[model samples]
Target: MAAVGNRLGDATSPYLLQHADNPVDWQPWDDRALALAREQNKPILLSIGYSACHWCHVMAHESFEDRDIARLMNERFINIKVDREERPDLDRIYQTAHQLLTRRPGGWPLTLVLTPEDQTPVFAGTYFPPRPRGGMPGFADILRQVDEAIREQPGAVAEQNAALRHALGKLSRAPDEGGASALGNGPLRTCRDALAASFDTVHGGFGAAPKFPHPGGIERLLRHYALTLTTDDEPDRDALHMACYSLRRMALGGLYDQVGGGFARYSVDEYWMIPHFEKMLYDNALLLGLYADAWHATGDGLYRRIVRETAAWTMAEMQHSRGGYFASLDADSEGEEGRYYLWTPDEIRGLLDDDEWALVEHRFALDEPANFEGRWHLHVQASFSESAKRLGRPRDQVVALWESARDKLYRAREQRVRPGRDDKVLTAWNGLMIAAMARAGRLLDEPTWVGSAEQALDFVTERLVDSEGRLHASWRGGRAAHQGCLEDYAFLLEGVLECLQSYWSDSRLRFAVGLADTLLARFQDEDSGGFWMTADDHEPLIQRPRPLADDSLPSGNAVALRALQRLGHLLGETRYLEAAERGLQAASGALARMPEAHASLLTALEEHLYPPEIVVIRGNMEATASWRARALKYYTPNRLVFTLPPAARPPGLLAERVAEEGAPVAWVCHGSTCRPPARTLDALDEVLDQSGGSS
Candidate 1:
């Protein structure tokens, strides 16, 4: 039999590298490992997790790092470790299989024992301890049980594997009957109603404890409110309140870094008082745009402050000097979760004067019981006005003192051991951030943020795309690896479109066109409808997922459909539009069944039902810039505003909308129809106000 040592030493993924020194003979999910497993007639032990996963780290220390456990793992099975971020394809397949077998939702550190020949999962679990605890089987016990099953009950194992394969196959196939003709507002309304029902009236956000930001759902609510605002319905107003309230609560909670600027993954409690602590690029990216839109909708200064601080934190800490954004920040620092972020009353008091300390104590609830392990993780327990009233100080004075105290605390926090950052630049995540930065920059009038987006776009185009124009999923330490997935193409296409709106670039337009073409050619499910998560030429896996529901990030299929619809309309390409409609048809059944779960797709469906309004401004560069800025003042979810210089030659439908005279002229098109060109800012405003409350 072929010998296997720890083969993850040469892996590009930081998550994989973290396990390189483990005693377990951990192999990266590769053909060689699979071949070895088959040859040895042993089941494949597949373990999947990402760098920021605290449980993944716990499993590694408790079991993978133990010599006796490693010995058992090496002797009984061919162990494969996958960084879920680096190989979401594998992660998705196994995670789904886990759910099917266990009848429970799957999570990180997913443990599965697969059939050697076909790689079908026969056993599934997650986060096994060193010894059995809390009714969970020990890692060693599970490993032995799996080995024994394969050896002594081969027929039963094979029977179960066959059933799982059939189940997975069923999941991959979309409903045959639903099509564009069946698509309607039922799902859209259902989604809004569901969100409203689950929304915590007092605390904000949806559901109970362990609250995720669910930015997609929040954005759905915002768009729904905008769409229905003209009807003057109380539910529409309530939708707006839900979105704004959730945004406010999250910004003020421990989920946000009180000392820093970025957000943690999610709040552990209903009140948003404690968080899981890992900071993800995708979460921030999605939330950035949400806050910007919220600011536009309500003109809330708090939303604007969140946008500024979060954007600053992203550029300062998460971005690579080469321009691409990094993947995530680990939940742990100094071997404990939330350690780097937590502090005592003494720490705050030492950093500020008596007045500042008093204000800080009340503002962040430092005087109250410790929220996390007897060390306070700052969350807004009282507003400035309330603190001002209680302390007999002016509100303005309280605010100023709080700011000073915050800066001091932040500076002091910087001196501590920081959480490890996963520095790999992922194309899909970078795409999300690019779109966020571009849109937020334009909305907030931050030119530097726009520049940052452009720089990141340039880096991805230069470093991640191959000679044949295919995108690499990830890049780090001068190497780009792994075939780009649907999200990589779809998200980047959306990003490119956003960048063009922020600052028109001819090369970027070409790039966007190429991405759209690639999606149609390489990723689209022509026979079924929605795009596959992997390209047609991707490495064969147990199953090819066509995901339409939003998870931590928005669904790739939904993003692809949205991007396609937008690009199709902008470029006047019927092919892209048709594909998007087909995708909506494919996802129609799923959307109807669980609309809230498919919030991202609900937005796409809304656009499909009511095509987005596209505004093209052409004239002298300086004059057109003013018109473009004016048009963007409102949060129009179903609008795309583009400005072009007189000398510029735009492609596709935009090519026909030429610059007239030396003055600015705006042409607004809804669906296939165009309104008369508006000559002045007043005329433009009148035209827009007539269009009113989004689509």
Candidate 2:
């Protein structure tokens, strides 16, 4: 065979483009590449990863860049490179297959060899080295062996592929036991109990070292606390403590960017003193809402500050000029992990005055041993009051000095070589960020944040949708590619609904309706319930996944179900309500087995069990504003408050809720029932009290 030249130069994904110049011939995953493998009778060598992945870069430099390894791969196999972010459908299927094959969890850079005839993965592993080390096989040797085995013993490969396919098919289908009765509070309680068991009392997060934020689990704790706040349950108080303490620790730790105002991927240590150093848009977006809600729940100044700073960082760094948010910042810069974020003691001291240095050294424990690679990654070691007392200065004076030091260090860090950023705008990720911005904006009374959300929504609707109104999953360099998956539709719908609460727009509501309708038509499984990750029209892969478990992102089916429920209530649409119920029935079996793993689905179930209260306020702008503000004073996850001026005409259930020109009137509804219109502020308060609005 002739040498295959790299063909990834035209790919839209930044991860794919990163390998365009590698010594290995990297073909983007497409029909042509798969066809070539089939024609040449070679097994497909599929390497899956994203641009921000640290190990992906390492593997690329170690094996893919080596001429000898490249020759072996090119001669033996048809190599295909896929950006997991761009093709999560493929990643999900293969990652699951990897687990079934290896009996171990999967991570990137995910390596696999698949039979060319049906694209069935026969072998799987992650991050193989060029030379054998750490008891792992070398990539070149693995390639030679796999190629020889496929040619010498084709029957063995076929048998394993058949078994793997059977296992994957079983995993893809929801269990038949799901029903209305299966959706119970047992799973909810089980999830809470599981979290309690795993909760680290000394530190803040669940489990031990290599701690992820687990925003979904933290959110479940918050909502659980809110639900049981009025009850006499002591566990509710403990739930609040766990959620708030975790937020506080995360904010004050190295996992959060002390200089830049965003969160790293995860903590590499239990103390939260070292992080993986990748700043992902989704992590920051999800954390923004959590911190904002924590502020609303406790009126904590720390939570508020974290929200403000993280939001500032997002808009300044992650958001594209076109309004969509980018994917993530790389973990490495200049070929070293965390090099861009790490700092030397001399660097910090030189940038600050003596008093400011003293305050910084005391507050961040710069006086102690270095944490990451013999250098500092700032984390709060002491409170402002402690630093003030230790320095014998006023608390306010110490805060001012610390602020000055941070600003100076931040400016100095800005001058350093920065981490590479993946600039592709993904619809699903942007949706998460949009919800965060809009929710925080409404809760914190920041109009700019709401405006940012609106702008992003506009970008998605205008740029990411095709002429026929189908949504695209990704956009970059003036091109939108790939049919939108379930998450793109579901998450963006969620964002649209959130934006309506922050600042209502008739067009946005229409967009949300269109999205919901498309989801029903294209993604929903009419027979089994829930939704497939890929659309009905998407190209066939090994398996069509209907994932219910929450991973780095929430489950698409769960988000879709939740969004449908909210929209159904808002519009009084029976179709959406019925669909949501069906989705719950579909996920019931999974919920019963391990509810802690499916926090998002449990959230949807919570709303199903206790239907959300919908409050519609109509009057002059000034009057409605006051009423809306009062209604949202408390953190009510199960309550939605929408305010409209008298001139505004809302659709569906809201159209019936009308007000006179000057009088401020409110209608409060729980599930299918609505209270009589309240003519005055006092009457509105009375109705809310009756409905347990604050609860």
Candidate 3:
């Protein structure tokens, strides 16, 4: 094929574009590259990674850009660069092979080798430095030995390739129908312990160095904590208390953008003090939902205000032309790290009068020698109560003054040149945003946010999910491309479900359930227990990882299983529940063996084993304005509540129990059965007390 240099320059993928000038001739995943490898009898050197991956950037700059390395790659291998985001299928397949061949785990900047005739990888690894470093092999050494082995022992190479391929084949097998596959809730205790041990008691996340904010993991903990505490029959965290502790801690940490009011992708340290600097839309969306819940649980207006400000920033900055949210804002701008976000002490002082500046500085702990290496990265000084106590004023007055200060500083910061925004509108990420906004509106009682969510949802339904109910994965500059994977389906379903609950819109729930069915039919890996990350019809990836567990975001299968369980409960269908159960069975083995490794997957299992309470209110969602309003009054992340018009019947799942009787009513269903309808606000409250999913 055309070497790595020629091939990569022609592709438009941002990740691929990031490598366009690499010395290595990096061809995109196109026919010419593969064909040339076969014709020349050279091994295919496949490299896979994404733009936001810091390590990926490092490897690209080190080996891929080195002329000597490029010469070796040119002389010895057929190189191809693939963007993991645009081609997750390819990344999945090879990542699986990388794990099997190396007898180790796989991650980005995946480097692999395969027979020159075709691209079946025989050897694989993550990053390889030019020189041996950190107990790792040098790229040149790996290249020389691997190439020599292939040339000198062709038969042996073929044998190893066969062995790896066979191993991968089994790793991707469907779940057991015989129910022999072993996994369950009993051992979930180990998973919980693992999480507890790793939890940064000081910070609000798991692990130490290179810590990522496991938003999903934290939520799962909150769900459990909320349940256990309220029941009081057992001793553990119930969902509400957990929802409170974890969210409050995170919001107070440096992981949050204390000044601009959004969350960074993660904190580099366990203390949540140092960040890698990129602010992602999905992270913000998920955090927004968390903050909204925090407000509901504690009636903390501060939490509600943070949610409101975050929503404002999201719409003001991240919203795409079609109403979809953009993926991320890069960590760097003007070749300076966090330049757009960080401010000098003098800059802060310049914006306010001497007294105001002193007050602001004292409140935020800002000093002459900046907290973040001479450039201040905004963060909170103390709890509002503590600050109020210190200020000798009422809490509300203190809060009001803090807001005034933040507003003044925000206006000043807005004038600076902003960071580069990756304007790619990914469906899954956008879906998270839409759902977050909608849920915030419902949970914290914000009508303005409800309007924002409606507009964004309208845009997604119109632009991404076409008339035929098919979903597209990404939209950029008016062009939507690629077939959507499971994440797109799962996250969008989340958005629709949130909208349905917020407004009691039958059209929204009806469509959400309809699309859920479509997802079941299209993305479900029937052979396995749950869903595939990518749809079955998409082109094969380099590696096909059968979603083993969750990561930064919730797994598609996890969300899907939850969706099925909720939809089935609302519609009162055993089929949906049955599908969910089957999915649990399929996922049981790994989840039990190492549930901590897959916290999100464990969450799905939790859902199937113990589904949430589904509260369906019929009549004008406006009629039960009091009851529907009551549902919105408290924060209940684990509860699924939706409103349907009296004239509009819910699916068989929810319709069987709730009255379509042309009057205002609220029906609470749990453990797959419904409590009688509630005709008044007090009646609804009583029903909630008796049968509601509230922990």
Candidate 4:
């Protein structure tokens, strides 16, 4: 085959590189591409999608690879390709533009036609076939029509540009009076009511089919339960129940890999039995922390098991050798979805002995009809307790048999062709995973996990972050490209903070402060009181989007707010606090209207309303370790723990506090007010009790 590459041959993003061989003259999202569009007076056809997106691959094959469609695109437009993961800021702007233009939710392989004059989007949509199908016009036809319209109806395009600008202005501006003085518990109540209304009683999770794991909402529920648990309120208990039930169902369902470990992108069914089967690093990372927290809250062994398995799976499969995590695993294997994961009853039977098959069949609902395209997506149909009782065997025996069967199955499945892995390391997603590993490792006493997190953080610092203390969005094949967005700083700052708790260092603390500074300088909307998705120096788009609503992942603005607040508390920086206040104020309106949708921001608000108690333990490493163990015994979300060694001279909150020469001394402090140092573990408990730390 002759080289048909245009500009994507040198791209770092695997998604863009995948289209390098396409006949279409694809260019990266850059100043050069935008300038070319303006110079040539051609419409900019921006196609945004990620590596793992199924429809993205379909469109690439059907249209981009087609010589006829490619010719039309190359001739009529300054074609640009974007990996959404690497440029979420661009994705957010265009996706919102698409929503405004079409009045429909925008998704992957987003096809947008923008005017060259202002780079204003005149038309937008998702995937379109090469030829007409399902009542939608063909990609080629759309391109031709858009080109003709741009040339012939310049006035109409100008009108759209003006209208879109107006809408964008309205959306970005802060409300008068900034928001309610105090949002209070009204928003919390609204969120609770909404979750209750949408809650699936039988199968768990919210809404209907094609369910996504709303980890942020689930965390809110858990926090809500913690807040009102002692009140003996029905709402509080119900919130906890819903969260627990949903988590339990997801863990047991096919969304969670039964044979292997880690979760799929989402389940395509309401029952959580059939997943789309793509494994993403971000999904598993968030779920790891969620399950770890659940275990801490309820002491559920199942949640513990899930945390262990998921973390293990992440390390085994998703993690890169050097340290950072990979982006995602594709949904298809050998051109068939779920081929790597699905198994038939006969296959299971052939793999297992008679006794093992009997237990496995009953446990996994093999007796029922196949639910996943004539194949069984293994889900726990019966609980272990029930299985033990039904099989007339001891619970321990049943567990042993199940473990044996799963090990054999996993080994056998490993021999099959695996799904394609998107090996690009994304800073934001890695930060999330790092936070998960750090927090879980600290709480669960898994040093290895903590080491993994540290290594990844180190990798990011050395490779992803450039000199002048700026972060890059993606790293692949020793090449780092694209300036970091708000998410990159916010999430990495979060990871640094979390990792600091597990194991502290002066360099890491400095790095955190640098990120916080960069966040404020680059992304903060100084006037509106919220952070913009893109930086001040980012490529000029139609609008600077400051989206607050939590999407598939938590909103970057929300994360920034929370991260800033946490940093403020840790470092005693009034600037961080002020910035966080502004962010909260900016978000107050959306939170007031539909708090359920702004779950991540609500979390930030919760921390703001009730400041976390700061516990600092100072002494020799051995003594402080003992004190740390005592403090971590109970599950306390509203507490920050720091075990400082004598050699360490901490700054900010712990700057004043010094190590007393003797056994470790624990000081339970809230802001500047601190009680006398507690010399013993018992004394520390007493101090904590008086300070309302135990509650």
Error of 1 at 350 (Å): 0.8
Cα-based RMSD of the predictions, in order?
1.5, 1.4, 3.5, 2.1
Q: Rate the local accuracy (lDDT) of all candidates.
A: 0.90, 0.90, 0.73, 0.87
Query: Which candidate, 1 or 3, has the higher lDDT?
Result: 1
User: What lDDT is obtained when candidate 3 is compared to the true structure?
Assistant: 0.73
- Please give the TM-score that candidate 2 achieves against the real structure: 0.98
lDDT of 4 by residue, 1-695 (tens): 23223899998888988999999999998778888888888899999998888888889989998999898888788899999999898888889888899998999989999887677899999999898999989988899888898889989989888998889877877766855456566777689789889999998899999899889888888888876743444437788899999999999999999999999998888999889888999999999999998898889999999999999998999888999999999988888788999899998899998878989999998989998888888999998889899999998889889988999999999999998999999999999999999999988999999999999999999999998999999999999988999889999999998898888787798899999999999999888788988899987777888878889888998889888888887778989989998888878888897899998888888778766667878888876787887777766766778777677766787687776674588888665467888888889988877755465
Return the lDDT, model 2, position 288: 98
Name model 3 segments beyond 4 Å from true.
Answer: 1-12, 21-24, 58-75, 99-108, 114-118, 122-149, 174-190, 229-243, 368-374, 385-398, 466-468, 504-507, 541-543, 646-662, 692-695
Model 2, range 574-632, lDDT digits (tens) per residue? 89999999989988878888899999899899988888888888887776787888789
lDDT of model 1 at position 150: 84
- Candidate 2 lowest-lDDT run of ten: 174-183
Ranking by TM-score: 2, 1, 4, 3
Candidate 4 wrong stretches, greater than 4 Å = 1-5, 178-180, 230-235, 691-695
Q: TM-score of model 1 relative to the true fold?
A: 0.98
TM-score of each: 0.98, 0.98, 0.88, 0.97
Clashing pairs in 4: none
Q: Per model, state how many residue pairs clash.
A: 0, 0, 32, 0
Between candidates 2 and 4, the lDDT winner: 2
